[model samples]
Target: MNNAIKDKVIEILSSIKSGVDFANEDQIVTGGILDSIDITEFITALEEEFDIEIGMEYMENENFDSVDAICEMVEELQEA
Candidate 1:
């Protein structure tokens, strides 16, 4: 996995929600760390930070589950 992308995603997630260790690639959604509002803000933050548009097809639980998945998705989108 790309460390740079993962780190940035962790940073974004941490900034959105405090007191949660985002370094373990934790399942934010399943763990109840990210609520509906947090998820919405998170989507905006990620789009702004990465400078990429997340299409509706890319909006899925698995894609937003962990930092690693998010990074992978970013990389894939970048490559595309």
Candidate 2:
């Protein structure tokens, strides 16, 4: 994973979960890995992390659906 993606994921997780360790890339961030509320917080964090404006279209299951998926979407958006 890209450094920016990893950093952003870590940043987002930090805002949502104080004590949780997000340094491990394999650490899940969805489906029992984190709560729904945390997901919302993660989305917000991503918006700020990448310094890009995200719309509803990017917030769907195809993008902000999971940690890996979200990282991919962020990288794509950054590239674009």
Candidate 3:
């Protein structure tokens, strides 16, 4: 995973909801750290930050579950 992307993802996740250790939390979606509205906001933020459109196909719980997962998704999108 890219450290820069991971850092930015953590920053974005923090902006959405503070006080959560995004880096260590592997169950962000399954654990309920972010709700439906927050997920919507997070997707928007991610799209704006990474300059990549997160289509419905990429809107999976596993895609946003952890910092690594988020970084992986962003990197994949960026590469595309």
TM-score of each: 0.90, 0.61, 0.96
Q: How far out, in Å, is residue 2 in model 3? A: 1.4
Q: What is the per-residue lDDT of model 3 for residues 1-80, given as tens digits with 9 covering 90 to 100?
A: 77888888899899989999888999999999999899999999989988999999998999988888888888999999
Candidate 3 regions exceeding 4 Å error are none
For each candidate, how many residue pairs have backbone atoms clashing (under 3 Å)? 0, 0, 0
Instruction: Give the residue spans of candidate 2 off by over 4 A.
Output: 18-36
Give residue 4's lDDT in candidate 1 (0 to 100): 81
Poorest lDDT segment (10 consecutive residues) of candidate 1 = 23-32
User: Which run of 10 residues does model 2 get worst, by summed lDDT?
Assistant: 24-33
Per-residue C-alpha lDDT of model 2 across residues 1-80, encoded as one tens digit per residue:
78767676777776777775656534343345666677676767777768766777775644544557667888888787
Candidate 1 local lDDT, residue 44? 94
Q: Which pairs, if any, clash in model 2?
A: none
* Candidate that would win on lDDT: 3
lDDT, candidate 1, 1-80, per-residue tens: 88888888898898988788877855788777898799889989988988888899998888888887888899998888
Off by over 4 Å in 1: none
Pitting candidate 1 against candidate 3, the one with the higher lDDT is 3
